[model samples]
Target: MSDATSARCVKCWVHGRVQGVGFRYTTQHEAQKLGLTGYARNLDDGSVEVVACGEGEQVEKLLAWLKAGGPRSASVEKVLTEPSQGDPTWTSFKIRY
Candidate 1:
């Protein structure tokens, strides 16, 4: 288990064939399972934006999943990630509009 005191946040923009394929829902489910707190939302540009926050290890796991092409039906082309503080007010993983 990762040390919660060393938690970090990341914002990922998943591109290519990611919209309308249950990506956000799957992301939320995976993040929640990892005990992460954040939100996944669809972008107008046809990508998916995910903000995840949690212990470093868990966040890394989530990133790996994202890099692997997201959910079952997603045809991920590229993923862009950056360090983010995310929402300090978030208490759980959810699919945001």
Candidate 2:
């Protein structure tokens, strides 16, 4: 395993009522608060995809928060998590196009 593998990185696909909402912003805020680094983007399928990396516990906490959906106006129906590739350095979380 590489050093990247030693660090915890979680890739998640969040579906249901996530787009057109503040989910991305809220997710960024939450991830930053947890000291995690990642990016969130709106998918063409109307879902939100996120990739977060940090300490094991912190990454898990970020995933859990995403599972609960974001702030008001967003309804997260499902959250699918998986391992990501490479070690992407994120200075700050942002919404991707």
Candidate 3:
């Protein structure tokens, strides 16, 4: 998708060894690199949940990277992505509580 049409948003659920590492931080970096605005957070179930809004290709790239295991120490097992609804008004990516 072109950057213009790619303004579509995405929300992802990442599973596996994604907690206690630098996943959130790394995700923030990646999101910033892609010019995405959203949040990443550790789920109570030991998974990482990421919501990003930006170009479709960039969002897909981020999802692919996360599926391949994030950063150096992450062991991602699965990644589920879906179209996001509503607006994305985040000024910066953050590690949500």
Candidate 4:
């Protein structure tokens, strides 16, 4: 099956100075570099939404990278784990906006 909107996944809301600092792009790079498929987008609430739709060991690596404050310009103070229903039409990691 394709990596559809209902893929097994982990969601995260990366907080603190995350926007406008290439967080989405950096995340896309990370995800793709790891041979994973997902999407990263900016939330209006000053946070970035990320999803890694796979398994624990693999997905957690992405989550760990996020919790570690992705990309230098973005000062990630906290990463909020959220429930994910996955996303639309994304075959590989990408920036949503």
Q: Which candidate is the best by TM-score?
A: 1
lDDT of 4 by residue, 1-97 (tens): 4443224677888889999998998998888876677888999999998887764456777888988889999999999887576665657887777
Ranking by TM-score: 1, 3, 2, 4
Model 3, range 1-97, lDDT digits (tens) per residue?
A: 4665557678889998889889999999999998888899999999988998877788778887888888888888889888787265577677787
Global lDDT of each candidate: 0.91, 0.82, 0.84, 0.81
Look at candidate 2 and tell me the lDDT of residue 91: 64
* Model 1 per-residue lDDT tens digits across residues 33-85: 99999999999999999999998889999999999988989999999999998
State which candidate, 1 or 2, has the greater TM-score.
1
The clash number for model 1 is 0
Off by over 4 Å in 3: 1-5
- Which should have the higher lDDT, number 2 or number 3? 3
Clash count of each predicted structure:
0, 0, 0, 0
Error of 4 at 23 (Å): 0.6
Candidate 4 lDDT for residue 33: 74
Ranking by lDDT: 1, 3, 2, 4
lDDT of 1: 0.91
Q: Estimate each model's TM-score.
A: 0.92, 0.86, 0.88, 0.82
